[model samples]
Target: MRMAARPLAWLLLLGILLVTVLPIEWRPVTGEPANLERLVAFALVGFVFVVGYPRHWWLVLGLVIAVALGFELAQLLAPSRHATLKDAVVKVAGGSLGVTAGVAANFLFTRLVPR
Candidate 1:
Protein backbone atom coordinates (compact mmCIF):
# COMPACT_ATOMS: atom_id res chain seq x y z
CA MET A 1 0.00 0.00 0.00
CA ARG A 2 2.83 2.40 0.81
CA MET A 3 4.46 1.73 -2.53
CA ALA A 4 1.27 2.72 -4.33
CA ALA A 5 0.46 5.70 -2.13
CA ARG A 6 2.39 8.42 -3.95
CA PRO A 7 0.95 7.64 -7.39
CA LEU A 8 -2.59 7.33 -6.09
CA ALA A 9 -2.26 10.59 -4.19
CA TRP A 10 -1.02 12.39 -7.29
CA LEU A 11 -3.86 10.99 -9.36
CA LEU A 12 -6.39 12.21 -6.84
CA LEU A 13 -4.83 15.67 -6.80
CA LEU A 14 -4.99 15.82 -10.61
CA GLY A 15 -8.65 14.88 -10.53
CA ILE A 16 -9.29 17.67 -8.02
CA LEU A 17 -7.61 20.23 -10.28
CA LEU A 18 -9.53 19.17 -13.36
CA VAL A 19 -12.83 19.22 -11.55
CA THR A 20 -12.14 22.59 -9.97
CA VAL A 21 -11.45 24.38 -13.26
CA LEU A 22 -14.14 22.78 -15.37
CA PRO A 23 -17.45 24.38 -16.26
CA ILE A 24 -20.14 24.13 -13.63
CA GLU A 25 -22.26 22.07 -15.98
CA TRP A 26 -19.53 19.47 -16.16
CA ARG A 27 -19.28 19.12 -12.40
CA PRO A 28 -21.06 16.18 -10.84
CA VAL A 29 -23.76 16.65 -8.26
CA THR A 30 -23.89 14.14 -5.42
CA GLY A 31 -26.91 15.81 -3.83
CA GLU A 32 -24.60 16.98 -1.06
CA PRO A 33 -24.03 20.65 -0.28
CA ALA A 34 -21.30 22.25 -2.38
CA ASN A 35 -19.16 23.19 0.60
CA LEU A 36 -19.51 19.75 2.06
CA GLU A 37 -18.32 18.23 -1.18
CA ARG A 38 -15.31 20.48 -1.29
CA LEU A 39 -14.49 19.71 2.32
CA VAL A 40 -14.66 15.95 1.87
CA ALA A 41 -12.80 15.94 -1.41
CA PHE A 42 -9.88 17.94 -0.08
CA ALA A 43 -9.84 15.95 3.13
CA LEU A 44 -9.48 12.72 1.21
CA VAL A 45 -6.73 14.15 -0.91
CA GLY A 46 -4.75 15.34 2.10
CA PHE A 47 -5.20 12.06 3.91
CA VAL A 48 -4.01 10.03 0.95
CA PHE A 49 -1.00 12.26 0.43
CA VAL A 50 0.19 11.97 4.02
CA VAL A 51 -0.43 8.26 4.12
CA GLY A 52 1.55 7.81 0.93
CA TYR A 53 4.42 10.01 2.02
CA PRO A 54 4.67 9.57 5.75
CA ARG A 55 8.31 10.61 5.91
CA HIS A 56 7.43 13.92 4.31
CA TRP A 57 4.30 14.66 6.30
CA TRP A 58 5.21 18.30 6.81
CA LEU A 59 5.74 18.80 3.10
CA VAL A 60 2.47 17.01 2.39
CA LEU A 61 0.59 19.35 4.71
CA GLY A 62 2.10 22.40 3.08
CA LEU A 63 1.45 21.13 -0.41
CA VAL A 64 -2.13 20.19 0.42
CA ILE A 65 -2.71 23.69 1.77
CA ALA A 66 -1.13 25.28 -1.27
CA VAL A 67 -3.32 23.14 -3.49
CA ALA A 68 -6.39 24.21 -1.57
CA LEU A 69 -5.60 27.87 -2.03
CA GLY A 70 -4.38 27.46 -5.61
CA PHE A 71 -7.37 25.43 -6.71
CA GLU A 72 -9.79 27.92 -5.21
CA LEU A 73 -8.04 30.63 -7.16
CA ALA A 74 -8.12 28.55 -10.31
CA GLN A 75 -11.87 28.87 -10.32
CA LEU A 76 -11.34 32.36 -11.68
CA LEU A 77 -10.17 30.82 -14.91
CA ALA A 78 -13.56 29.23 -15.39
CA PRO A 79 -16.16 31.77 -16.37
CA SER A 80 -18.88 29.62 -14.91
CA ARG A 81 -17.12 29.26 -11.56
CA HIS A 82 -16.67 31.78 -8.79
CA ALA A 83 -13.93 31.94 -6.21
CA THR A 84 -14.72 32.86 -2.62
CA LEU A 85 -12.77 33.17 0.59
CA LYS A 86 -15.35 31.14 2.48
CA ASP A 87 -14.93 28.20 0.16
CA ALA A 88 -11.17 28.30 0.45
CA VAL A 89 -11.35 28.37 4.23
CA VAL A 90 -13.61 25.37 4.31
CA LYS A 91 -11.27 23.41 2.05
CA VAL A 92 -8.23 24.34 4.12
CA ALA A 93 -10.02 23.35 7.29
CA GLY A 94 -10.93 19.98 5.85
CA GLY A 95 -7.46 19.29 4.52
CA SER A 96 -5.94 20.20 7.83
CA LEU A 97 -8.19 17.76 9.63
CA GLY A 98 -7.29 14.99 7.21
CA VAL A 99 -3.60 15.62 7.51
CA THR A 100 -3.90 15.49 11.29
CA ALA A 101 -5.69 12.18 11.12
CA GLY A 102 -3.15 10.82 8.69
CA VAL A 103 -0.29 11.75 10.97
CA ALA A 104 -1.94 10.10 13.96
CA ALA A 105 -2.64 7.00 11.96
CA ASN A 106 0.92 6.81 10.77
CA PHE A 107 2.22 7.19 14.29
CA LEU A 108 0.01 4.41 15.61
CA PHE A 109 0.83 2.13 12.73
CA THR A 110 4.52 2.56 13.25
CA ARG A 111 4.31 1.96 16.97
CA LEU A 112 1.91 -0.98 16.92
CA VAL A 113 2.47 -2.73 13.64
CA PRO A 114 5.29 -5.23 13.41
CA ARG A 115 7.26 -3.11 10.99
Candidate 2:
Protein backbone atom coordinates (compact mmCIF):
# COMPACT_ATOMS: atom_id res chain seq x y z
CA MET A 1 0.00 0.00 0.00
CA ARG A 2 2.83 2.37 0.90
CA MET A 3 4.68 1.65 -2.30
CA ALA A 4 1.58 2.24 -4.41
CA ALA A 5 0.88 5.47 -2.60
CA ARG A 6 4.40 6.72 -3.30
CA PRO A 7 3.83 7.00 -7.06
CA LEU A 8 0.56 8.82 -6.62
CA ALA A 9 2.24 11.19 -4.22
CA TRP A 10 5.02 11.84 -6.69
CA LEU A 11 2.54 12.60 -9.45
CA LEU A 12 0.80 15.04 -7.17
CA LEU A 13 4.11 16.69 -6.33
CA LEU A 14 4.96 17.06 -10.00
CA GLY A 15 1.60 18.63 -10.70
CA ILE A 16 2.25 21.08 -7.86
CA LEU A 17 5.61 21.98 -9.36
CA LEU A 18 4.04 22.59 -12.74
CA VAL A 19 1.49 24.90 -11.25
CA THR A 20 4.15 26.76 -9.29
CA VAL A 21 6.36 27.32 -12.34
CA LEU A 22 3.62 28.42 -14.67
CA PRO A 23 3.47 32.18 -15.03
CA ILE A 24 0.13 33.87 -14.65
CA GLU A 25 -0.89 37.51 -14.79
CA TRP A 26 -2.01 38.86 -11.44
CA ARG A 27 -5.47 40.30 -11.73
CA PRO A 28 -7.53 40.54 -8.58
CA VAL A 29 -11.23 39.96 -8.92
CA THR A 30 -13.72 41.95 -6.93
CA GLY A 31 -13.58 41.11 -3.19
CA GLU A 32 -10.42 39.09 -3.65
CA PRO A 33 -7.18 40.28 -2.12
CA ALA A 34 -4.17 40.51 -4.44
CA ASN A 35 -1.92 38.10 -2.58
CA LEU A 36 -4.63 35.58 -1.76
CA GLU A 37 -3.87 33.37 -4.73
CA ARG A 38 -0.19 33.11 -3.99
CA LEU A 39 -0.76 32.38 -0.34
CA VAL A 40 -3.12 29.59 -1.22
CA ALA A 41 -0.67 28.17 -3.71
CA PHE A 42 2.17 28.09 -1.21
CA ALA A 43 0.02 26.64 1.51
CA LEU A 44 -1.32 23.96 -0.77
CA VAL A 45 2.13 22.92 -1.89
CA GLY A 46 3.38 22.69 1.68
CA PHE A 47 0.35 20.79 2.80
CA VAL A 48 0.66 18.34 -0.06
CA PHE A 49 4.27 17.56 0.80
CA VAL A 50 3.56 17.25 4.48
CA VAL A 51 0.73 14.81 3.94
CA GLY A 52 2.57 12.90 1.27
CA TYR A 53 5.78 12.51 3.21
CA PRO A 54 5.14 13.18 6.85
CA ARG A 55 8.42 11.63 7.94
CA HIS A 56 10.43 13.96 5.67
CA TRP A 57 8.58 17.22 6.13
CA TRP A 58 11.77 19.18 6.75
CA LEU A 59 13.41 17.82 3.65
CA VAL A 60 10.32 18.63 1.61
CA LEU A 61 10.24 22.13 3.06
CA GLY A 62 13.90 22.66 2.22
CA LEU A 63 13.37 21.51 -1.34
CA VAL A 64 10.34 23.79 -1.71
CA ILE A 65 12.39 26.78 -0.51
CA ALA A 66 15.21 25.92 -2.86
CA VAL A 67 12.78 25.60 -5.75
CA ALA A 68 11.14 28.91 -4.89
CA LEU A 69 14.50 30.65 -4.78
CA GLY A 70 15.46 29.12 -8.07
CA PHE A 71 12.20 30.20 -9.63
CA GLU A 72 12.71 33.75 -8.31
CA LEU A 73 16.20 33.86 -9.74
CA ALA A 74 14.91 32.56 -13.03
CA GLN A 75 12.44 35.41 -13.17
CA LEU A 76 15.37 37.75 -13.77
CA LEU A 77 15.77 36.20 -17.20
CA ALA A 78 12.36 37.36 -18.30
CA PRO A 79 11.90 41.04 -19.12
CA SER A 80 8.35 40.88 -17.80
CA ARG A 81 9.28 39.15 -14.56
CA HIS A 82 11.77 40.80 -12.27
CA ALA A 83 12.83 39.04 -9.12
CA THR A 84 11.85 40.65 -5.82
CA LEU A 85 13.10 40.10 -2.32
CA LYS A 86 9.56 40.63 -1.09
CA ASP A 87 8.22 37.79 -3.23
CA ALA A 88 10.93 35.48 -1.92
CA VAL A 89 9.98 36.41 1.61
CA VAL A 90 6.32 35.83 0.86
CA LYS A 91 7.04 32.46 -0.65
CA VAL A 92 9.00 31.35 2.38
CA ALA A 93 6.26 32.59 4.71
CA GLY A 94 3.53 30.86 2.72
CA GLY A 95 5.47 27.62 2.46
CA SER A 96 6.21 27.63 6.18
CA LEU A 97 2.60 28.28 7.11
CA GLY A 98 1.43 25.50 4.85
CA VAL A 99 3.91 23.07 6.31
CA THR A 100 2.78 23.94 9.80
CA ALA A 101 -0.85 23.50 8.88
CA GLY A 102 -0.12 20.20 7.22
CA VAL A 103 1.80 18.94 10.22
CA ALA A 104 -1.07 19.87 12.47
CA ALA A 105 -3.51 18.14 10.15
CA ASN A 106 -1.36 15.03 10.07
CA PHE A 107 -1.18 14.96 13.85
CA LEU A 108 -4.92 15.19 14.04
CA PHE A 109 -5.39 12.50 11.45
CA THR A 110 -3.02 10.09 13.20
CA ARG A 111 -4.74 10.68 16.51
CA LEU A 112 -8.09 9.93 14.98
CA VAL A 113 -6.94 6.87 13.02
CA PRO A 114 -4.72 4.06 14.22
CA ARG A 115 -2.39 2.06 11.92
Candidate 3:
Protein backbone atom coordinates (compact mmCIF):
# COMPACT_ATOMS: atom_id res chain seq x y z
CA MET A 1 0.00 0.00 0.00
CA ARG A 2 2.85 2.37 0.84
CA MET A 3 4.68 1.92 -2.45
CA ALA A 4 1.53 2.07 -4.57
CA ALA A 5 0.02 4.95 -2.67
CA ARG A 6 1.81 7.63 -4.67
CA PRO A 7 0.83 6.46 -8.13
CA LEU A 8 -2.62 5.50 -6.95
CA ALA A 9 -3.05 8.96 -5.60
CA TRP A 10 -2.12 10.50 -8.94
CA LEU A 11 -4.37 8.11 -10.78
CA LEU A 12 -7.23 9.02 -8.53
CA LEU A 13 -6.66 12.68 -9.17
CA LEU A 14 -6.43 12.09 -12.89
CA GLY A 15 -9.60 10.08 -12.79
CA ILE A 16 -11.39 13.02 -11.27
CA LEU A 17 -10.03 15.29 -13.93
CA LEU A 18 -11.10 12.95 -16.66
CA VAL A 19 -14.53 12.47 -15.23
CA THR A 20 -15.07 16.16 -14.81
CA VAL A 21 -14.21 17.27 -18.33
CA LEU A 22 -15.94 14.44 -20.11
CA PRO A 23 -19.66 14.60 -20.80
CA ILE A 24 -21.60 12.45 -18.41
CA GLU A 25 -24.96 12.48 -16.64
CA TRP A 26 -23.42 11.92 -13.24
CA ARG A 27 -25.24 14.35 -11.00
CA PRO A 28 -25.86 13.38 -7.39
CA VAL A 29 -29.53 12.61 -7.04
CA THR A 30 -31.44 10.03 -5.02
CA GLY A 31 -30.65 8.72 -1.53
CA GLU A 32 -28.08 11.11 -0.08
CA PRO A 33 -29.05 13.70 -2.73
CA ALA A 34 -28.04 17.35 -3.13
CA ASN A 35 -24.28 17.87 -3.13
CA LEU A 36 -23.52 14.56 -1.48
CA GLU A 37 -21.49 13.35 -4.43
CA ARG A 38 -19.32 16.43 -4.30
CA LEU A 39 -18.38 15.59 -0.74
CA VAL A 40 -17.59 11.96 -1.50
CA ALA A 41 -15.67 12.58 -4.71
CA PHE A 42 -13.52 15.39 -3.36
CA ALA A 43 -13.07 13.51 -0.11
CA LEU A 44 -11.67 10.52 -1.96
CA VAL A 45 -9.37 12.79 -3.94
CA GLY A 46 -8.15 14.41 -0.73
CA PHE A 47 -7.63 11.09 1.06
CA VAL A 48 -5.57 9.55 -1.73
CA PHE A 49 -3.63 12.73 -2.29
CA VAL A 50 -2.62 13.16 1.37
CA VAL A 51 -1.91 9.50 1.92
CA GLY A 52 0.34 9.51 -1.10
CA TYR A 53 2.26 12.62 -0.10
CA PRO A 54 1.87 13.09 3.61
CA ARG A 55 5.27 14.81 3.72
CA HIS A 56 3.85 17.53 1.46
CA TRP A 57 0.20 17.50 2.36
CA TRP A 58 -0.04 21.24 1.81
CA LEU A 59 0.78 20.73 -1.83
CA VAL A 60 -1.99 18.20 -2.09
CA LEU A 61 -4.37 20.72 -0.55
CA GLY A 62 -3.45 23.30 -3.13
CA LEU A 63 -3.72 20.78 -5.92
CA VAL A 64 -7.20 19.75 -4.82
CA ILE A 65 -8.33 23.35 -4.74
CA ALA A 66 -6.88 23.82 -8.19
CA VAL A 67 -8.70 20.77 -9.38
CA ALA A 68 -11.97 22.14 -8.06
CA LEU A 69 -11.45 25.45 -9.79
CA GLY A 70 -10.25 24.00 -13.05
CA PHE A 71 -13.14 21.61 -13.28
CA GLU A 72 -15.69 24.33 -12.73
CA LEU A 73 -14.11 26.55 -15.30
CA ALA A 74 -13.83 23.76 -17.83
CA GLN A 75 -17.54 23.19 -17.48
CA LEU A 76 -18.09 26.48 -19.28
CA LEU A 77 -16.96 24.85 -22.49
CA ALA A 78 -18.42 21.42 -21.98
CA PRO A 79 -21.15 20.58 -24.48
CA SER A 80 -23.80 19.51 -22.03
CA ARG A 81 -22.50 21.25 -18.95
CA HIS A 82 -23.37 24.70 -17.76
CA ALA A 83 -21.00 26.68 -15.58
CA THR A 84 -22.32 28.22 -12.41
CA LEU A 85 -20.81 30.04 -9.44
CA LYS A 86 -22.99 28.16 -6.99
CA ASP A 87 -21.71 24.80 -8.10
CA ALA A 88 -18.17 26.03 -7.87
CA VAL A 89 -18.67 27.18 -4.32
CA VAL A 90 -20.14 23.85 -3.27
CA LYS A 91 -17.27 22.03 -4.91
CA VAL A 92 -14.60 24.15 -3.27
CA ALA A 93 -16.21 23.87 0.13
CA GLY A 94 -16.51 20.12 -0.23
CA GLY A 95 -12.91 19.84 -1.38
CA SER A 96 -11.82 21.91 1.60
CA LEU A 97 -13.48 19.48 4.00
CA GLY A 98 -11.91 16.53 2.20
CA VAL A 99 -8.43 17.99 2.33
CA THR A 100 -8.77 18.71 6.03
CA ALA A 101 -9.94 15.17 6.72
CA GLY A 102 -7.02 13.74 4.81
CA VAL A 103 -4.55 15.90 6.69
CA ALA A 104 -6.02 14.90 10.03
CA ALA A 105 -6.04 11.20 9.17
CA ASN A 106 -2.43 11.30 8.03
CA PHE A 107 -1.37 13.13 11.18
CA LEU A 108 -3.00 10.56 13.42
CA PHE A 109 -1.62 7.61 11.47
CA THR A 110 1.90 8.94 11.46
CA ARG A 111 1.83 9.66 15.19
CA LEU A 112 0.65 6.15 15.97
CA VAL A 113 3.09 4.33 13.72
CA PRO A 114 6.57 3.51 14.93
CA ARG A 115 9.09 5.75 13.21
Candidate 4:
Protein backbone atom coordinates (compact mmCIF):
# COMPACT_ATOMS: atom_id res chain seq x y z
CA MET A 1 0.00 0.00 0.00
CA ARG A 2 2.77 2.40 0.82
CA MET A 3 4.58 1.66 -2.44
CA ALA A 4 1.46 2.23 -4.49
CA ALA A 5 0.73 5.46 -2.67
CA ARG A 6 4.19 6.81 -3.42
CA PRO A 7 3.89 6.28 -7.18
CA LEU A 8 0.44 7.82 -7.23
CA ALA A 9 1.78 10.80 -5.39
CA TRP A 10 4.57 11.19 -7.93
CA LEU A 11 2.15 11.01 -10.82
CA LEU A 12 0.04 13.67 -9.20
CA LEU A 13 3.09 15.84 -8.83
CA LEU A 14 3.94 15.40 -12.49
CA GLY A 15 0.42 16.35 -13.43
CA ILE A 16 0.71 19.53 -11.42
CA LEU A 17 3.96 20.42 -13.15
CA LEU A 18 2.50 19.84 -16.55
CA VAL A 19 -0.52 21.96 -15.80
CA THR A 20 1.65 24.75 -14.50
CA VAL A 21 4.26 24.84 -17.28
CA LEU A 22 1.86 24.60 -20.18
CA PRO A 23 1.27 27.78 -22.06
CA ILE A 24 -1.95 29.51 -21.18
CA GLU A 25 -3.12 33.02 -21.82
CA TRP A 26 -4.08 35.07 -18.85
CA ARG A 27 -7.61 36.24 -19.36
CA PRO A 28 -8.34 39.80 -18.51
CA VAL A 29 -10.29 40.19 -15.33
CA THR A 30 -11.90 43.25 -13.86
CA GLY A 31 -10.05 44.38 -10.73
CA GLU A 32 -8.45 41.04 -10.01
CA PRO A 33 -6.47 40.93 -6.82
CA ALA A 34 -2.69 40.96 -7.12
CA ASN A 35 -0.58 37.85 -6.51
CA LEU A 36 -3.62 35.59 -6.54
CA GLU A 37 -2.17 33.37 -9.25
CA ARG A 38 1.10 32.95 -7.47
CA LEU A 39 -0.66 32.05 -4.25
CA VAL A 40 -2.79 29.47 -5.99
CA ALA A 41 0.22 27.96 -7.71
CA PHE A 42 2.14 27.73 -4.47
CA ALA A 43 -0.81 26.26 -2.55
CA LEU A 44 -1.59 23.67 -5.17
CA VAL A 45 2.01 22.48 -5.42
CA GLY A 46 2.39 22.48 -1.64
CA PHE A 47 -0.84 20.57 -1.11
CA VAL A 48 0.24 17.90 -3.57
CA PHE A 49 3.51 17.32 -1.78
CA VAL A 50 1.88 17.48 1.64
CA VAL A 51 -0.70 14.84 0.79
CA GLY A 52 1.56 12.73 -1.42
CA TYR A 53 5.02 12.48 0.12
CA PRO A 54 4.46 13.43 3.70
CA ARG A 55 7.48 11.48 4.89
CA HIS A 56 9.86 12.78 2.22
CA TRP A 57 9.22 16.45 2.07
CA TRP A 58 12.84 17.16 1.21
CA LEU A 59 12.77 14.85 -1.77
CA VAL A 60 9.64 16.49 -3.05
CA LEU A 61 11.14 19.90 -2.52
CA GLY A 62 14.28 18.99 -4.40
CA LEU A 63 12.30 17.52 -7.24
CA VAL A 64 10.27 20.70 -7.50
CA ILE A 65 13.41 22.82 -7.81
CA ALA A 66 15.03 20.49 -10.29
CA VAL A 67 11.96 20.36 -12.43
CA ALA A 68 11.61 24.12 -12.43
CA LEU A 69 15.23 24.51 -13.41
CA GLY A 70 14.88 21.94 -16.15
CA PHE A 71 11.89 23.75 -17.56
CA GLU A 72 13.71 27.02 -17.60
CA LEU A 73 16.61 25.46 -19.43
CA ALA A 74 14.29 23.86 -21.94
CA GLN A 75 12.79 27.22 -22.70
CA LEU A 76 16.07 28.23 -24.25
CA LEU A 77 15.54 25.76 -27.06
CA ALA A 78 12.54 27.64 -28.29
CA PRO A 79 13.25 30.90 -30.06
CA SER A 80 9.95 32.25 -28.80
CA ARG A 81 10.53 31.12 -25.25
CA HIS A 82 13.80 32.53 -24.08
CA ALA A 83 14.99 31.75 -20.59
CA THR A 84 14.60 34.49 -18.03
CA LEU A 85 16.32 34.73 -14.64
CA LYS A 86 13.19 36.30 -13.22
CA ASP A 87 10.99 33.38 -14.22
CA ALA A 88 13.51 30.95 -12.81
CA VAL A 89 13.59 32.88 -9.56
CA VAL A 90 9.83 32.87 -9.34
CA LYS A 91 9.69 29.18 -10.04
CA VAL A 92 12.27 28.43 -7.41
CA ALA A 93 10.55 30.63 -4.87
CA GLY A 94 7.18 29.06 -5.59
CA GLY A 95 8.61 25.57 -5.33
CA SER A 96 10.41 26.37 -2.11
CA LEU A 97 7.34 27.94 -0.56
CA GLY A 98 5.27 24.94 -1.60
CA VAL A 99 7.73 22.52 -0.05
CA THR A 100 7.72 24.46 3.20
CA ALA A 101 3.95 24.34 3.33
CA GLY A 102 3.97 20.64 2.58
CA VAL A 103 6.45 19.97 5.35
CA ALA A 104 4.36 21.89 7.85
CA ALA A 105 1.23 20.08 6.79
CA ASN A 106 2.97 16.75 7.10
CA PHE A 107 4.11 17.57 10.62
CA LEU A 108 0.63 18.60 11.66
CA PHE A 109 -0.94 15.54 10.13
CA THR A 110 1.55 13.20 11.73
CA ARG A 111 0.95 14.74 15.12
CA LEU A 112 -2.79 14.62 14.68
CA VAL A 113 -2.86 11.00 13.57
CA PRO A 114 -0.36 8.45 14.72
CA ARG A 115 0.86 6.15 11.94
The most accurate candidate by lDDT is 1
Q: Please give the lDDT score at residue 41 for candidate 3.
A: 78
List, residue by residue over 38-77, the lDDT tens digit for candidate 1: 8998888888889999988889889989999999999998
Q: Cα lDDT for residue 8, model 1?
A: 90
Tens digits of per-residue lDDT, candidate 2, 5-110, equal 4566567556545444455454224466635655666767777777878888898789768766776677776555667887777776777887898789878988
Per-residue lDDT tens digits for candidate 3, residues 2-23, read 5677898778777767767777
Q: Count backbone overlaps in model 4.
A: 0
TM-score of each: 0.96, 0.74, 0.82, 0.65
- Give the range where candidate 1 is weakest over 10 consecutive residues by summed lDDT: 1-10
Q: What is the C-alpha RMSD of each candidate to the true structure, in Å?
A: 0.8, 3.7, 2.3, 4.2
Better of 1 and 2 by TM-score: 1
Q: In model 4, which residue pairs have backbone atoms overlapping below 3 Å? A: none
lDDT for predicted candidate 2 compared with the true structure? 0.69
Q: Candidate 3: which stretches are off by over 4 Å?
A: 26-34
Q: Which residue pairs in model 3 clash with each other? A: none
* Alpha carbon deviation, residue 70, candidate 4 (Å): 0.8
Q: Clashing residue pairs in candidate 2, if any?
A: none
Model 1 clash pairs are none
